[model samples]
Target: MAAGVARSDDLRREPVLPPGFSLVTLRESGDAFGHAQAIAAEAGAATLVWVRRFDIVEFAVVLEPDAILAEARLAHYLAMNALADALAIHSPPERPLLFRWPDALTYDLGLIGGGRLAWPADCPENQVPDWLVFGAMVRATTMSPFQPGQTGVGMAEEGFEEVDAVDLIEAFARHLMLGVSRWQEEGAKPAARRWLDRLEKVTGVRHGIEPNGDLVATSQHGVERKGLVEALAKVDWLDRESGGPKL
Candidate 1:
């Protein structure tokens, strides 16, 4: 796939987008995250790159943060919470939408998909990078046969047959806008709190998201922190060979 934003001159042909945002649709084989990151410097901000695929909702957005990279990395939490909230809105009211630490998303205890973040590799931690790319994918349909003990589910398999990929992408955009506004108005704590709420709770451990997006767990053994950047480098839900969620 070409590593750049899809030509935006055809904005008139794009779907209705939220204010300050533009859409760049890609073919089924495109990689939304890579394209967004590749052209992030020229795309400016609020450019949403989406891949048209029947079995998954794959998309990425370009962001230009005002804060330093150290502080801005926390925005990953906002994006995660927004994604979870978007899924929750269309999911069954009783269905539990949970998060696995920094990125993975789960529904009713079954693996769904998750979000990812990318910035310039050479960018300093305390400096503001020119752009940040947040990408996410949700399994919409399972390509494989259902096993006797499968632990993963697609949106269609989870009773959301009527909700298509476009619906989820639009929902994510709207929710992400709200999340960004909340962070702008009240700071990162609100987003962090929301993320912590959805995080899979571990008994006897106090969970918190550090300023740099690390996952912190405080217990009787003092404190432990997991680097969000490191965790993001290896997405647990993805199958490297298939370039899709693990089946």
Candidate 2:
């Protein structure tokens, strides 16, 4: 179910989003993605549902696209691209922010968080759905002592002194605008290349996204494919107990 939402009454200031975007702020425990999915029809396009918390940055954006859900799911890549740019805006020089496609964001190879997608349950892949939601969660601060062999990290602990949950959210919105414009002007190639650039460099390998949003890799051996739909169902980086990225 969608969680309850309010505006600036609970915030010092609302996120600075582009003109077409609106925000619904949720309390710490609220599920931004679920809420955005639930109210997509009425809330409409570019509605960003954000969970206010200091320990982790969590939010979801509502999208109303004309393409069928299968094709429209590529918006997930666009969201990740924007997120990469957002973190870069505040990251220390040379801090490597990496991504594992379909879903997973890492910093210096440690799991920080990633993204998720949700659409109408009854919507058919062949039909244009009412909306799609791309939700992202990033660990903002560590609340517990670090354990040996742990691979998760919070932004602050990694020298991201200038980044906070709210700041990153605002930056993401700004970059998303450029992503949309780039998609309009140059087609998917530009966005796909940007997303591809951040992955671990592999020699003799090439990557691309298919029209249906599959992750495709071509190498001297052969071509391999991964379905976006199936991949989205697996939350490999999520730590269910803490409701944050895996550690």
Candidate 3:
């Protein structure tokens, strides 16, 4: 990893980025999400902050939404949808991509990574958010440098081949922009449908999103919908201990 860093520094001082997006390259030691959230107010929309590293691909995108916090969170699903779509670009055909609801993403039935949201503490739920930040991270390669066959977290023991970290991030940004455009043109319904399609399909459970930002699900013959917001609140994101995703 240190060698990669030295090579990157010697190669180009500026990071290559897509159109309409500004890049903020952080030192390999910096936290992409925390940094983006701290400066989102000034960074504005589509500002992508990424940490150039060898073992992981960590990045965040800043957004200025027109809706209040309540409804704005639906954008989280859009971010995940974009992520899955982005991975599909490099994955083999029929590689299963699924979302574990509210948060967490998987590839080919293996836990890979997920998206998260952040906003200012003072931001009011009723007032439209000035800026909303969506961030994501994926483990590109295991750090068990000496033992290539050693098992690691989740199903990461089965490594992906021929794919690089930057490819996924770049693909995600492009797909996310497309999702934002789709939401504006058609509405959240289309986005919701796309998100639902990628969920880990469960039998006999009918799922739907309420207008006020709750995900509701019920058994085929059930009488009421189960509110999913409560479940989503307990996500072990930010790994309270390390203040980052529980890798």
Over the stretch 1-247, how does candidate 2's per-residue lDDT look in tens digits?
A: 0111222342456778889999999887898888998899999999999988767789999888777887777888888999888987777768688888768998888888899988888999999989989999988766666789989887767777555566788899999888988877776667777888887657898888888889888999999998988988887878778788888
Task: Please give the CA lDDT of all the candidate structures.
Answer: 0.82, 0.82, 0.70
Candidate 3 C-alpha lDDT tens digits along 1-247:
3211123433235445668889888877888888999999998899998887655667899989888877887787888788788767755576686777777777665556667788667877788888988888665544445254422232233334455556667788889889999999987777787888888877888778775556677886774554444545576443656334454
Candidate 2 deviant stretches above 4 angstroms: 1-11
Q: Which one wins by TM-score: 1 or 3? A: 1
- Give the clash count for model 1: 0
Residue 86 displacement in candidate 1 (angstroms): 1.1
Error of 1 at 155 (Å): 0.8
Tens digits of per-residue lDDT, candidate 1, 43-122, equal: 88999998877677789999999888988988888899888887887787787899987788998888888888998899
**Model 2 accuracy (lDDT, Cα):** 0.82
